[model samples]
Target: MSFLLRFIAECLFTVYSVSFLLYHRRNFLMKQNHLIFFLISAVINWSFSATWGLAISSHYGAPALLLIVLLELKGLYQMNPMQLLFESGYFVAVLYWGRGIVLPVFALILNQSVHWVRHNRFYYPVAWILSLCMILVYNMLFRHVIAPKAKVETFYRSKEQIRFVAIFQVCLLGYLLFINLGRYYGVDLPWYKISHIISCIICFAAQGLLVNRGIRNSSLLEYELHTELLQQQLERNLRHYKAYQKYAESFRAFKHDYNHMMTSVKSLLSAGEYQKAINLLDTIHETRHKQVPVQHSYSNNNLLDSILQDTANRCEEQSTQFSANVYLPAGHNISDIDIVRMFTNLINNAAEACAKVTSDSERFIAITSRFISHNGWLQIKTANSFHGKVLIRNGIPESTKPNRDFHGLGLSIIDETATKLGGIMVIDVDQKEMVFKTTLLLPVNIQQWNKKDRLPVRGG
Candidate 1:
C-alpha cells in the first residue's frame, strides 16, 4: 500500500512537471512531436522512482535521470544545450525540494490542524487530496506570475545568469540532500518540523529574489535595445531627408537651364545649321543627365520608400546587389513605425547575409510585395545570398554569433511585429542555391487600391 501511494505520487509529479514544461516552453514544444517526449520522460521518471523508492530515487537516481532528460530534450527541441541543462537542473532541484520540504511541511500543518479529531480511514485520503490541491495552486502561481516575470528563454541567455541559477539550484539540492540524510539516519528531533517550515520560507524567499532580479535585468536590456533601434531609425530618416534635399536642389537647377537650352536649339535651327541644332540638343540632354540626381522610388509609401532607398545605398557601398518592388498603399491600418521596424530588420538581415558571401556576383538581396485584394492580405518576400549553415527552431533562425545574448533579436522582433499586426512570417533556406528567403503575409484593407489599379515601384 505504501509503494502504491508512492507510485501514485510519482505519477502526479510527472503530470505536474510535464504541465509546467508545456506551459513555459510552449513556443519550443508546440512545433515538435512533444507528446512522445513527455510520455518517455514520464516513464523514465516513474521507473526510477518505483525501483529505488522516492527518497532513494531523488538522491541517487536523479542526476543520471537529469542527464537523460537533458539529452532527450536537446535531441527533440534542438535548443541551446546550456539553456536546456539549466532548465532540467532547476526542475530536478524543484522536485527534490518539494518532496523533501513542501510535502512534509503540508503534512505537518494538516496533522496539527486535525489532531482534535479522532483518526479515521479517510484521513490519509484527505491529506493526499490537500497535497494535490497545494500542487495545483503552485502551478497556477508559477504560470501566471513567476514564469512571465522570469522567462527561462531570456534568463538563460547570459553565462553569468546561468551560473547564478546553477548555484541556487545546487544550494537547493544540497539542502534537500541534508534533510533526506537526517531522515535516513532517524535523526528527527522535536524542532525538525519547525526547521522544515523555516527552510521552506527561506527557499521561497531566495527563489523570489532570483526571479525579481531576472525581471529587472530583462526589462532593462529590452529598453536599451528599443532605444538603440529608435536611434538607428532616426539616423536613417535624417540621411534620407538629406538625399531628398539634394535631389530637390538639383531639379531646381535643371528647371532654370531648360529655357536657355531650348532658345539655343531654336536659334541653330533657324540659321539652317541642322548639324549644330542636333549637337546643341545632344549637349543639353547630356548636361541634364549628368547634373540631375537620380532618385529611385521603390514603394508608394514615403517612409518605406525612404528606408528601401537607404538600404539600396548601403548595399551599393557594400558591393551587394539590392532590388525592391513594393507597392504599399497609404492608410493600410498598420502603423508606419511597425512597417519601418519590420522592413528595416528584414532588409538589414538580408544585406548582412549577402555581405558574408565570398563571391561578389553571388551577393544579392531581392524584395517583392503583392497585395491580394480578395483576401485582404499583403504578401512580401525577401531573398538573399548566404554561404553557411542556418539552424532554425520554432520557425526562427538561431543566432550563430559567439555572444548570442545580444545578436539574435532581429528576426524575433520582426516575427513579433508581424504577429501583432495580424500577419505571419515564414523563413526558408535553400542550401543548393545558397539563398535565404523570408515570406511575410500581413492583413490589410484598403478601399482605394485594387489588384488592377495598383502600380508597383521597382528599383535596384
Candidate 2:
C-alpha cells in the first residue's frame, strides 16, 4: 500500500511539473528546441538509473524509491516509464540467471549513430560486451547480482563487440511488451520483432511528446520572467504619471488665484490704492516664491517605486537632480504585467544616461505623463540634461560616447510597447539647453480620443 502511494506520488509530481511547464510556456511545444532538451535528460536518466538497479536492489528498493517519487512530484526530469520498468526487469533477469537483456532504446540510438559518431572502432561491440562481462563477473565473483555504472555511455554501441547483444536487446523489448500486452490494446500478437517494433514506435511517440513538453516548460519560464519585468515597469510609469497630474492640478489652482489677485491690483490702481496694491504685489511675490520650490515625485506603487527610487538615488549619488512623474489610468484597462516592462526598462535607462555625466549640474532628468484631454490616450515625456552633443535619430538616442559597441535600445522598448498598443512615439532634443525628451502615446482607447490625430492639446 505504501509502495502504491509512493508510485502515485511520484507520477503526480512529474505530471504537475509538466503541467506547470506547459502552462507557463504554452507555445513551447510547437518549437523544436524542447526536443533536444528532453533527449539530453533522457540520456542522463536512462544510463544512471538502470546501472543502479542492477548493482544494488536498494537503489530502486525503498528509500531511493521514495526519493524518486518525491523528485517526480517536484518535476525534476528523470527516467521514463518504459526505461524504469525494462531496466528493473533486466536487473531481475541478470540476478536470477536468465538470458542477457539490454535497453533496446539504446540499441536503436547506437544503430543510428555508430557510423556517424566518429567511426568509434572500439565503440558499440565493446560497450555491450563490457556491460555483459561486468554482470557476468559480478555473478561469478560475488555469486550475486551487481549493476554497473559507466561515467559516460549511450546504448548506440559500435562495430567492435559481438553483434548478438543488439539482437538480445531487441528480443528483450519484444518479450517484455508481449507479456504486458493485456494491459494495453487488446491485440493478441505473440512477443517478437513486430511486437517490439510497435512498442519502440510508441516509445518514440512518448519521447516526442516529452520533448514538446520540455520546450513548453522552457518557454513558460521565459514568459514568467517577462511578466515580472513588465509588472515592475508599469508601476514605475504609473507613479511618474500621477505625480505630474497632482502637479498640474495644484499649479492650475495657484494660477487661478493669481488671476483674481491681478484683477484686484488693477482695481486698486484705478481707485488710487497704489501703495496697497504695491504691498499686495509684494505679498504675492513672496507667496509664489514659497510655492516655486516645485517638487514632483516619480512613482507611488511600492513595487515600481523601489526600481525608480533605487535608480534615481543612484543618479543623485552621482549628483544628478532626477525627478519623475507617474500617473495610472483611472480604470484597469492595461494589465499590470505589461506596464512593468515599460517603466522598469525606461527608468533604468534614464538613470544610466544621467549617471554618465561628470559635472554635478549637467546631470538631471524630468519625467511627466498625462491623459490627452481626459481621453484614454496617455502621453509620456521624459526629459534629461546632458553636457555633450545629442545625436538623436527617429526617437532613439545615437550615443556620442566612444568605445561602446551598442547604441540605444531602451527607447526601443517604449516604442515596442507603444506599437503593440497601436500608438506612435516621438523624441526631441535641444542641444543648446542640453535636454532630451521622449514622448509616447499610452495605449488607452478613450471614447473622447479621435483616432485621426484631431484632439486638442489642453493646458490642464
Give per-candidate clash totals. Answer: 0, 31
lDDT of 2 at 385: 70
Positional deviation of 303 in candidate 2, in angstroms?
3.8
**Best candidate, lDDT-wise?**
1
In terms of TM-score, how similar is model 2 to the real structure?
0.33
Residue-wise lDDT of candidate 1 within 252-316, one digit each (tens)?
89989988989988988999989999988889888888888788988887788878888989998
Models, CA RMSD each: 4.6, 19.3
**CA lDDT of every candidate:** 0.69, 0.47
Error of 1 at 251 (Å): 1.0
Report how far off residue 238 is in candidate 2 (Å): 19
